[model samples]
Target: MEREIFPWIGASRGTSILISKKKSFHYTDVIANNSSRYIIVSGIPQHRKITLINIYAPNSGQLVGDPILLGGDMNLVNNPLLDRSSRPLPADAALSTALDELQRLLRVTDVW
Candidate 1:
């Protein structure tokens, strides 16, 4: 995952790229894609650290200003009518409402 990642980015003739905690972003989720899977996150070096969130899981309310490619599995059911579940739970209007509110807050729309 590290080979030829940033062919366009490089240090100046006399400048060197400094790698450190402040120059990168890190995140992890256990229930999204696996029981436990570690993911390496990073941002543009020399810039402020960026925070990334797993929107589908909603671990944090902080939304990325850029378009977020949210993809995950948290076993959450916002719409029983459209979303599938192994054991269907009673549909709650409040849950649906909350989901709508979340989508609006994030300015994100479902693909389907």
Candidate 2:
């Protein structure tokens, strides 16, 4: 599996890749820096290609359309603790915003 790392916001990142198997498939990993919100999208090769997305949202949402799976993480888990005592701490909101933007871009791109 070949991988490519595409950085969006500072420290917050996302990855896009092409996995070679019996058929070629595309994948994207969107990760936030401070939050536990990580979204993944996988595309299967077929006449009617299937797109599967694994999302961790700390809120409610719905899945729309075929070959698309939408989910949320209503409860916050796996999120690192904030260090207010430190010189500076990254904001979770920023990271969450970045991940959201990345997801939108990946969904529209043909490379996915």
On lDDT, the leading prediction is: 1
TM-score, predicted candidate 2 vs. hidden true structure? 0.23
Write model 1 residue lDDT over 1-112, tens digit each, in one string.
Answer: 2222212224321211223443343322212223212222344334555433222222344655645576655345567666764555665556777777887997877775
Candidate 2, residues 1-112, lDDT tens digits: the string is 4443332324343323334455655443334344434434544455445544333433334534435445544222122244233333355556645555766876732221
lDDT of 1 at 93: 52
Worst 10 residues of 1 by lDDT: 29-38
- The segments of candidate 1 whose C-alpha lies over 4 angstroms from its true place after superposition are 1-67, 85-87
Off by over 4 Å in 2: 4-18, 26-36, 42-44, 55-112
Against the reference, the lDDT scores of all candidates come to 0.44, 0.42
lDDT comparing candidate 2 with the true structure: 0.42
Q: What range of 10 consecutive residues in model 2 has the weakest lDDT sum?
A: 74-83
